[model samples]
Target chain A: MAIEHSSVDLSDAMILEPTALADWIITAPVIIPLIAGALLLMIRHETRFHAGIAIGALLLALLGHIGLLARVLETGPLTMTMGRWLPPFGISFTADVLGASMGLAATLSALVCALYSLTDIGARGRRYGFYGFLMLMMAGVNGAFITGDIFNLYVWFEVFLISSFGLLVLGSERRQLDGATKYAILNLLGTTLFLTATALLYGALGTLNMADIARVMPEVQDSIPAGTLATLFFFAFAMKAAAFPVNFWLPASYHTPRIAAAALFGGVLTKIGVYALLRTFGMLMPDQLTLLSTLIAWVAAATMIIGVMGALAQTDLRRILGFVVISGVGTMMAGLALGSVEGFSGAIFYAFHSILVMTALYLLAGVMNGLAGTYSLRTLSGLYTSHPLVAAFAFLLFLAVSGLPPASGLWPKVMLIRASIDGGAPWLAFAILLSSLLTMLALGRVFLLAVWRPAVEPSTAMVVSPGIGYAALLVLAVPIVWMGVYPEPFANVATKAAAGLTDTSAYIRSVFPEVVQ
Target chain B: MQTLIFRTAAPYISSLMVLFSIFVTLRGHNEPGGGFIGGLIAASAAAVYGIAYGVPAVRKALYFHPMAIAGSGLMLSALSGVFSIFHGVPLMTGVWGSFGFLGATVDIATVVTFDLGVYLVVLGSFTSIALALEEREDG
Candidate 1:
């Protein structure tokens, strides 16, 4: 209890008057998929219908998120509490530009993944609740991105985690079980740390609403070990984001699942952790973020270098992509470590870029694997001649992910590196540059060996994949190419989103508009 | 162990526990019991029945796949929240209604429906896990 807060508070902070009906769109992103997912459960065995239902649900969610982003951009920020309860007592959903854009990116990535699932998943997989898990996971991811309640954020984490556990083990393969085990143990530790930190945070601040905590953080900072709490949260989120030291879980397990599931994990899952870190530090406690920036910078450097190195050493295409995913995490973490508006904006932009490009890469992996009848690079070759269209898609995603020109990945990397150098961290900038080079090399090698090299005699005939898989990949690829070509609008959104995060006044005020006076 | 004495009494014990679970669920809004705890209690009843008899027997008695029940429970919970959208309020806003029967008022609320959904989810999820484990042991 901030005994000090209640005295000066607007006595009416706890009450509400009737609002416009259209305001309900705030929760539509989460609610849409949740209802659809639950409905899909009743008929879980109907694989034929599952893909359509999942796609429809995801499209609805994507539209809702697009609407939310547009609204937040036009307005400043939006806030809605569950059950019409007052702030601090009821869980609130705060949608600022950052959260809305991320939600939109996540929903779009998920929709593409769902579409890919149609080609990648089978009747047996569908019967086991593939689409249902995808929807539920999206619910969790979107909820976490936008929730204004820290405890509710934890709940959303569990929602996604449980659904991911289901997604990871969809095939019941030995490799999947082995991978899921590592994924489970480490992730469980992360959640436990998250919960413990949340409890301590609540104990320190006497509130679970995120904005109120920020409002009271300055006063509470002196008495509590905010650093320790921050460390706990950092580690928890780092593990989730697959940052270095605890990131082994991602590369180990992601490659084991269906490529569709892996795509979701690679593209959207770890980004949740990154989003949580940015939201907590950038918005909730800017001082702690500043204090911890040096250590974060070191982590960022190590992650970038190590992640790319790991990718270079892998021969399996999926495994190589897994490490590539980790490398992207390092780049985003660099953005956080810099702690500038450009840095945050760059990170946000990268995250959206990463979601689209990474998911597309994974979908391409599925397509390539389908055609080659394997994920092994050693036995695959001559795709340039045999499947030029598929090989063309692969080349575009490669350029995009490697931070090359004419692709979305280039802009964020530029912004982040420039911000790092400008912020007086040349070494951090160097690490990012080094990672980009190594990433380009590693991925280019994948293309050279798997797609362009002279024909290797096929041990087996290529598996003809469905056109839907290519469609899904195309959906994800367009944004990367378009955003690259038309960077001004998207870059503007990223900057606006970052501006909201670096200055917490707007975010906090969204939650407690009356507290401003 | 599926002993004779336990098997003989399992049915009656399960029935009583289920009845108590419903009581707990209904009273949850005003008291300590809610869908979560009530569900656990109901699940324990199912587990006890499975221990005395078998998974097939419990499955037959239940007459539905446990996961299906869980899924429907989720739908119900979501719909209860959506009920507020019809009233032009934020999601999960509770709406209250009352009916008169023989000059006595009967109150109904979306909150209870949400709680009941939670109860079913807990019951279904726990029962399925317990049944799966037990069935594996038997086989």
Candidate 2:
């Protein structure tokens, strides 16, 4: 059945597109955090109370996003035009099921990260500014997912970057400074490339909106250099996503911060890059994407293997989790490369699942390190006996992250495997399975060294922080089971989100009306 | 050698430049001036202050930490987006209304809010880097 929709026709006549309150609701996911972030900056002096405000803002944003998700599910994709300017003249915000769902997930993750930071950050330093930066990062991630304008995506990237720099260096320790410098320099380079690509795309398409570019891209094949522009966009996203060769920046830079900061970066930052990749290639430049998908698949395979290998080599607890998170990026991108509905769905599902699982794992690692004194495997032991509750939660998160049964990670892997087999890429499926097994092995190693090994010298005792870390752990832990046990609801949302992404026509119709021949 | 570099650049040069940075941010939307450039300029101004004056002097002169300013800028920019919802528009959408500016109508758009957000973000971010580097130098 054809979806009944209304849109403005600016090509010939200036007709107002029929819109709804739902449009406003869909945009709330981004709006709430943005507002909260602004409110947060005003009262930075109340250092003691800033956590409350930050957590409150995150909770409100989560609620607002949940409300938006409900409306989008009841309806279809929701679209809003900025400044009442007609499409092609003004920017648009589109909340397809995927964008809103991912947005909600991002907000929820940020909220937990904020809670986690309360204890994690306070112990390391007293930087009240981190909360505002966290809020800004959330705003950037949410904006990137929902934005239908290409240039706005770049703006959102900057937002995420600026805040990220603060969070990375919040402690101002020697290691943090070094890591932040590297992180900042690499990300700045990525931003430059991204801006160049954006300028080139605008020059090629004459419009900066994604939907407009998609509509005009096919027509300009003969006149413009689509291949060159597509490559530019692809390379920029690859660097941002940390795919293979460009992936070094992530593991090198991410390990320097406190657990809460690391958790947020692990969960949200890279995903923004992944989201851009999926949106731009899957929607805007579909034909050119097919040509590049094979190369991306190889890169995905390499990233997976290398990331897992890197994880195995790490002695630091946060570093291991960091590598695992990087490896998972490959799995997500692999599904995107497959270019099948099931593959895309699996990719999006994996992304949703990984954010929860990885964030929880990092928090759990933080808890262990807090209790055990040091994050080094050689330094930690008997965590299971001393902190069984933490062990159980970490174990569950481990199983979930490793794609083991009774958790959400399994289903996405299953879907990805099936998609690969159906596409006749048995080697790709083999690679994914091998990576999953290796991921399981890597985490198992962490579990062994961290939980099962004999207790070390009695002088080094684990001191668990009260209130903040435990509270954050509880907040993140609940969803790992909820999403795993009853995956249908979120899975449905993800499928809808994936479908919205794959169907460029629907996106076009939402942004611009069909020009009369 | 380092002190020589500091002595070469005038002490007021940085503060004067910072004032110009604020000007760029304030007038961003209509002209080429916007938050990113303005923030960068402000940051450079602070960096100059750091070199000409001692790091501690620069820090004391600012009164607030560089990171705090960045945080405040981020908040301001984000507030601009949030304020649009009261007018029944989407987040980050430019909402235009006219107000009397000395008997002349002035357009207040949401883009201005966004620009302000950008301004704060750039200002806060760059200053933090500058301050962090200064602290490293002292150590």
Candidate 3:
């Protein structure tokens, strides 16, 4: 195969000598939960111990991610090829700042979700091995983040998909089954598209290692199929991320699952799609993305408008949050479409913010549903008066997500606006502003109707929610407030991560040491 | 609905299929047949049993739970990867060990262990789902 690489000659690109002991950190995040999840499946007879094992595994993963992040931040990206094989030939898992940070966010969100599951998951869900599925999903998420091979990314996606399929139908309710069917079918389509694109990409570039493809992309002659490859990837990722046109599945199905299941999905699943989009477009295919930037910007605008409009029209609280999740996707997509350092950084920042805040929002929604005995806004009232702590978390998340000041969401919006103007697209900035307004308006309606509305006897339901659920919500909320208060450190990390995305020299050098002159 | 011919032949047929699956799994690292294929083959054996006899008979033939088997397979695969850490290599790094037994040398590799794990997981997961659906149908 004639591989045209306009970048540095990779013939000289040497693999880095594996660090003896510390390399385990790179694999720990994926392996710990995987082994735990597998073992948990064996002991399904004892449901009581599943939650503890899952939580412990997640905490270990989180610590590993934190360590990996710190190391990557201090050093550069850390790369390891499976079986100590050479790069390109071996599946490599690399943790750059962007990947590690996202991994950390995912692990944190998953840990909270696991904790919340202990209180929120019913006996039927537990009996069906919810914790085991949750751990497996976490392993998949971690694997996807750190994997350096595009093909491996697809594998991880499947792992998560299978586990999520298990989680989605854990309750086996009629509504859940209906939702899972739609979710499964659409996602399968997306997966097929992803695989086809990946095959074409490998055919064109003659390599599946992401860094190698990026290194060689400039040299590959532009063709119709090349353009189609980008479009295929866009559709595949967009469907998963629940972008404008293909977002119906999310709102249609998300609210039907158990609250913890929905919360996990809301928190990290779509964000994985977003992460893949940003990684591919921002890092691997920046030049191609620049060509399609205008179209992408328009998609961003439409997604933002449609998502908020959908949220505005929903009467169910979780459904409203579901729409809000879609709008958040649009916001990050707008940043991604700009295809600049500021834009990429903003997208990463917003992704972390979205993951945490969305999970917290859904957890709060679950709490509300538990207390009121229904998710319908028409029947639920006096939450602010009855459950002030829960109501406070909801209000904080609402403000944060609406891009209000003193919240982390505002800083990312500012960066995206700056990037839009800098990238010569003022209309995108206007779309973002307009979308934020719509989000506030839609979410404000919910606030007025559900929280501020007059007392309606407080629908005294048997709330079996344990204190851990509340604790999980609070644990997730802390990061949003902290990031909002002190944006500098986090922004610095994001800025460096964004630099890694745009300038792949360091990443390529890390993976292929021999290539560096 | 069970046919007399199927009931008479199922035991031998399933046993042979299970043996073939193990053989395929053991050779998967060097050849086309690995854990996934072996698992499918094994699961098919269970499926055949279910069709000829019933879900309960199939379940009894496979003493352990299908989900548990799958989980154990997953643990085995993960541990195989972790085993390299003890050798100061990256996770999933292939490490080989050989021992001289009498006049023959016995060699072992983590890849084969990992492959076996994959086989068990696939066999266990599919069979469990298949049994669940089939049992539900019977009820």
Candidate 4:
């Protein structure tokens, strides 16, 4: 894509005036973290300041993404091409409601994590680069969501993957190393598959821009192994999402990191996989997605069932939360499998919903660990008598995660179930209900054992959860509770995002205005 | 393990490679050479120097922590893109600047600053890793 310096007028296209302020909004989520993370990395000995900068960086990124989301919701998709090069030539960052909302949600969750790290992350962990890696991961997550090119998506994947690897083993504990080892091997495999799929798709279509590929998919479908390529993409994202049998690595490794790190991982890490699925299959290759819908539905059911069953078997609180994360992925996958406007909306809503709720759940796990000095459910008791507010927060978040009424999780689950029924997939509807029921049972059991039951023995050490820690949980809880109470505004955006994915005309039009069909 | 001839030749090779690395970085957009390769060459020069002398000597010569250099480069690379924001363009849009001095014109671009940042990051990270490995070996 070399620019031919044929004339001055042609050169003028290279430096168009930054009209309309949307251009800056399009790329700020990525660049802010890139600058802030690197700056944080240079200062090796200031935990207080490092945490402050990390929070500031994420807060700024979240604000930018909020602006981006508002613009996308008000108007349509936003596009920014690198070096002023047009699409199918230069790399582009394109954001629709789906990407914009995802970025904002991830940034919000990450901001909470950064704040919580102030009290939760020890000086040793801060010295080892907690905030730096967290910001680095946010950059990757936002980039993956916003990029219009498939290859750029893979590049962003690697960026976040490397950062996660850094965060996973930051403490260099034996268990952390062991968990990181497993995490690395599986994720690398997933990344390699993703790269392979991207390469093969590029070879088949001769283009890597997502919108370009979608536009050309019909013309090229007959010539290429489009189904297999789609499956390759599906397989890569499924493994990454920890859906069904491919999910072992998530449970094995996710519980090992520090809670702040784990909260971020639980919040947006798996959702990235789900987001990629939605972008590639829902928006970019709907036909291929339709072709593979049934198999995906079955996989989704299995992922939901097995994930909750694993949670039921786990006594480790953090470990149970990891399984709960896996089950939520199933719910998102089920939404993907439905392949309807409602289903897509449900999935989009669920991913953002899960990002907020699941992250808070993990942070709650940390706060509980701070209070009770453990992650094990067995030796913990009488949380209600001691910390009624913590118990109440736990109760609300559990209600949300398990898809009980009047919590954020319930809306997405209802949307998904309704979508499945409307889409004539009663079995999927049944599966969703059954998984939610089991999740409630599992979490209810946790509540009974940890919060309701009296103390098994007299407690010795009293480590009250830090003020910042509660503030972090409060920050996260407010959103979950708010979304639960008044979901119309957010749900409306989700509907639009789903619509944008289904019809990608606006998305494609944003990237290449002249090529709109 | 270093012989007299090897030690004597190392310094010349190292210095020449460092010089060539800068040339490569300068000609990066026009030619095949770029910041990444340039940085690799520079890092290799440092490694060779460390082999000839010691990690301590290389550290003294560098005068800054390798990670600090890498971090500065990251900041530079990121800020280079930020320049476009103030100028009213998307991030990474290449804006040009020209300066007239002594009846001569000098042109500069954000892309070059980005490349330089990439160079420093690569050089810093690789040199640090090399230093760490060599220190462990000497220990």
Best prediction by TM-score: 1
Residue pairs clashing in model 2 are A38-B75, A98-A497, A371-A462, B28-B33, B70-B124, B73-B120, B77-B117
**Docking band of candidate 3:** medium
Pick the winner on lDDT between candidates 3 and 4.
4
Candidate 2's DockQ is 0.27
Candidate 3 stretches with Cα past 4 Å from truth are: A1-19, A458-460, B100-103
**TM-score of candidate 1 restricted to chain B?**
0.95
Worst 10 residues of 2 chain A by lDDT: A1-10
Can you write out model 1's per-residue Cα lDDT over B49-121, one digit (the tens) per residue? 9898888889998888888888899999999988877775667877888799999997778899999999988
Query: Model 4, range B1-139, lDDT digits (tens) per residue?
Result: 3699988898899999999999999899778999899999999999988999999989997888888888888888888877776666667776678799999997788888999999999999899899999999999
lDDT of 4 by residue, A276-388 (tens): 99999998889999899999999999999999999999999999999999999999999999999999999998987899998898998888888888788988888899889
* Model 4 interface DockQ: 0.57
Ranking 2 against 3 by lDDT, winner? 3
Binned by DockQ into CAPRI classes (incorrect, acceptable, medium, high), candidate 1 is: medium
Q: Model 4, residue A93: displacement in angstroms? A: 0.8
- The residue pairs found clashing in candidate 3 are A12-A514, A12-A515, A13-A514, A13-A515, A14-A513, A14-A514, A83-B93
The fraction of correct interface contacts reproduced by each prediction comes to 0.68, 0.38, 0.82, 0.63
Ranking by TM-score: 1, 4, 3, 2
Name model 2 segments beyond 4 Å from true.
Answer: A1-22, A123-128, A466-468, A513-517, B1-139
